[model samples]
Structures are given as structure tokens and as C-alpha cells.
Target chain A: MGLIDNINKLFDHRIRLGIMSILMVNDDVDFNRLKELLDVTDGNLASHTKTLENAEYIKVEKAFIGKKPNTKYFITPLGKQAFKKHIDALEDLIRNPK
Target chain B: MGLIDNINKLFDHRIRLGIMSILMVNDDVDFNRLKELLDVTDGNLASHTKTLENAEYIKVEKAFIGKKPNTKYFITPLGKQAFKKHIDALEDLIRNPK
Candidate 1:
């Protein structure tokens, strides 16, 4: 939604894209780690994650490093494909801006 | 959610991304045109449009060609900037698909 207004439900908003960017880099990242990397608020991050989860772009893994309960996130196979396609579509837009 | 599962609050969803894509091409595609181009339902298009409108990415112009009611949409200046940035980010991802 930030700058990509005309674009479809693919890659437009800021926060949702940010989450995907980080996950694209790391094999699997946790909630706290994502929060730290992106510097997003708790509630904001939660809702955004919920949206992605509903879309099934990312899979949540509830576990713990030691004692503390933690939620880890990783891009699903499907998510990876989406990320690639989104990038392709974005590249097309840039190559041919209107 | 189809393929882009891991990305962030940015350009991750399918429907939203689709809408942006069509708008990116045509200057001012109408509701029916968009719905037809994107093959989306009325409520779905409405909700997505609301989100983009709320994001201030697209401006709606309501007028009549000749008594028949009408509405139109165009990308905002800010939305243009965001689209460019988003494309750059997406390019980065595609170049290095992790």
C-alpha cells in the first residue's frame, strides 16, 4: 500500500513485503528475530503474520530454544514460489513502468 | 498465498497484487474493468480497493459519462514511488532467490 497502489494483491504493502524479504534471506527465522530485523511492533507484527499465515506464505513453528516458548517462521515451498513470482512481476513492472 | 508465502506485509498476496498490476498498466481502469481484468468478485474487489484507497495509493473519481453512474481510479504520486521501490526490492529478491 505504501507506494505500490496500482499493483494487485501480490506485492504492494510495506509491512507484508518486509516479512517476506527477511524470510527470503534466512532459511528459517523466529518471531523475535523478525521483530528485531524489521523493527515492527508486537501487535502490528502479529496481525501481519496472521495475514501471511492465512495466505499460507509462511508456516509457524511453535517451539522453544530452551525454556522459553518461541514461535519460529519459515517460508513454505509455496511461499518460496510466490516470492519468486512476485519478484518476477515486480521486475516486469519496473522494466515497463506506466 | 498461492506461491508467495514467506514475504512480508508488502507485496505477498495474490488478489491485492493482481489489482495493482492492472492499475499499473492502464491510467484509470474502472471497477468493472478491474473486476473483469483481474477476474475478482465484487466484494473482493471492493475490499481490496478500500485497502488501497485507505493506503492513499489510488484516488477515486466519481462522475457520469452521460447520466449513467460511474467511478474511476488512478495511481497516486506516492503510490507510483512505492511501486518503483517495490519493484527494486522484488528485483533484489529474484536476483537472489534464497
Candidate 2:
């Protein structure tokens, strides 16, 4: 639902983009799981996830897997396209560096 | 000197990474020009530039072009490599997005 903005810079911010890129590769990553992998704080993870959710780059689902609650995340189609455009832009940059 | 990091999301920040990528292709760019092109504020651009400068991803030179002062920015060798790695990471993301 969004056009390809120069997402290199938009999604290139380490934390936010990391969340999206990882989610794209993994079917579903839980909050604590990503937090451990990225070594980011809980608040940091939550805030970045909120921003991605607002941008519709990812979808978040909350459920229970036994007694404990679980949160799962997935990259959206729009996000995949955006990531593709960003990669294309990067490739262009690599081939045309001054 | 630095190794390739997962830059897919690192340089993707619109302001910071745009600054680097534009500088790469254009040789150098002025602060005001970038501010106008990116439609960012003075403070926002300044802060973001500081972050890049701190990361050693760019070099800023302050000089005078007549009576007024001018600031010029260029991507360093380290910065260029970092940008390359980031692009590579983005490409990886694009090729294998889930």
C-alpha cells in the first residue's frame, strides 16, 4: 500500500530494519527471542516494533502457547517489496560509487 | 579495518544513510542542499550528520566560499566500505525475503 521511498535510509536504521529483515527470513520471531538475538533492550525492541507496525511493515499476533503468553511477528507483503526496492537501490549505489 | 556488519537496517535510516549514499555518487554535497533535497530541518540534519560523523562513516569539512561559511561532506574509505556492506546485506535480504 506504500510506494518505494528511498528505503535504504528508512529501513537502514540498525534496530528497526533489523527487526524487519529478521522477520522476513524467519517465519515468526517472538519478542524475547529477537531481544536476545539482537541484544537490544526490551523497551528498545518494543518501541521499534511499534514503529514497524505503524508503518505496516510487519504484523504482530498475540496468543498463548500453554500457560505463558506469546507474541509472533511476520513481515508483510508491502514490507517485502520495500525491502526489495531498498536492495535494488543499494545495488545501484554499489555499481555507481564515486 | 572494520568487518562487514549486517547493514541492511543500519544505513537504511532515511536521513543518515541518504546522506552517505548521495555523497557516494555525487562526490560531495553541501548541508543546505541536502537539507532541501531530503526535506529535513536544520537541527534534524545536523544531528543525523553528527551521528554519521561519529561513526566515521563520513568526513565533514568546514570552510568559506567567499564571505559566508560552507560545510562540505564526503564519504571516507571506511564509510564507503560500510555502505557497500550495507548494500550487500540489503541484497541478501531481497534475495531471501520470507
Candidate 3:
């Protein structure tokens, strides 16, 4: 009940939801790969990533790829828990609508 | 590829996604009941319902329940098709991350 409200607010945006969904299944997602998969602009992906990162739902890893820097993202334990909860809330809403 | 992008844009909002999910399983849902289930305000639900209605994903039915007006929603055939496609697209994004 209350959990559903939280779930709705947290995953209200599609880009954010997509980011979580991608990070949930993959071991670690690269910045470029997310942009490609989500097909969002660089600015769009960066802003959304920042939101998730600020929430501590994801941790960013940076490395040097030759001369260029590569960024990768990994879901934290907390992120996994929250994302799972959100999914479960959605399922509950679908299965048992009051 | 392109499909994922379209899917992202279409189901980007949680409320819209929620509406589709609820209607998917139930034959018809009342407006007030939806407000109760989603735990959203009247204005909030109305705006979201308008969006989904504009998308033609759900059809609205109006009837009088004892002198009171009752508005119920049912997913149209097209709506069902789109919802299924959107889900398949999400599954594709999750299962085969390419």
C-alpha cells in the first residue's frame, strides 16, 4: 500500500527505470553501452545516471582506455534491494488491485 | 535497437505503465478504484488517465450507479497489443543486452 506510492515516485521516469533495469541484469554497464542501449543522448544519459548515482543506487567506476576515459556502472546492494522492491510493488499492484 | 528506444519513450512513466498493467489483468477498472489502488490524488490520476486515453490504450465507459456517475476503464484491443509489444520490448532489452 504505502510501498506502492514509494515505488511509483521512485520509478516515475522511464529513463530512470530503464537505467535500473539495465544495471539490474548486467554485471556492469559501460557508459557508451547504456547510451547505445537506451538510445538516449549523452546529456540525457549523464543526467539520469547522476540522479541514480546521487541516490547511491549505483556506483561508478572509471578507467583509462588508452587516452580516453571509460566509465562503468554497478548496482550497489542498496540499489538492488530498492529495485527489487519496486518490481515487487508493481507485481502486487497488478496481481491484487484493491 | 530502434524498438528499445520506442519502448523507453512509450512506457517512460510509472503511472502510465501501472495503468496498463492493472487493465491488462482485470476486465474493467473503475476510476475511483484506480485512484485507491495507485494511491494518487484526483488531479494526478486524471492527468495520467488523459495521457493513456490520448494514446488510445484504454477505453472509458460511463454509467450511472444509482444516480451517481461511474467511469470505468477497459483496455482496447489496440491497447492490449501495444502493451504486449511494450512488454516484449522490455524483455528483449533485459534478456538480450546487445
Report the C-alpha displacement of residue A69, candidate 1, in angstroms. Answer: 6.9
Model 1 lDDT per residue over B1-98, tens place: 11123333434555566666667777898887777766667898888888888888788898998988788988888876676565555555445533
Quality of candidate 2's docking, in CAPRI categories? acceptable
Q: Who wins the lDDT comparison?
A: 3
User: Ten residues in a row with the worst lDDT in model 3 chain A?
Assistant: A1-10
lDDT score, candidate 1, position A75: 84
Point out where model 3 deviates above 4 Å. A6-8, A95-98, B6-8
TM-score of chain B of each: 0.82, 0.87, 0.90
TM-score of 3: 0.84
Candidate 1 residue-wise lDDT, A1-98, digit = tens: 22233443634555677678778777888887777765677898898888888889998999877999999998888877887676665655445533
Local distance difference test, per candidate?
A: 0.68, 0.72, 0.79
Write candidate 3's Cα lDDT for A31-86 as tens digits.
99989877888998899899899899999999989999999999999998998887
Prediction 1 TM-score vs. true: 0.56
Over B1-98, each residue of candidate 2 has an lDDT whose tens digit, in order, gives 11113754446566676677678787788898878766788998899899899888898999999989999988889988988777676555445533
**For all the models shown, what interface RMSD does each have?**
10.3, 7.0, 3.0
The positional error of residue B17 in candidate 3, measured at the CA in angstroms, is 2.2
Worst 10 residues of 1 chain B by lDDT: B1-10
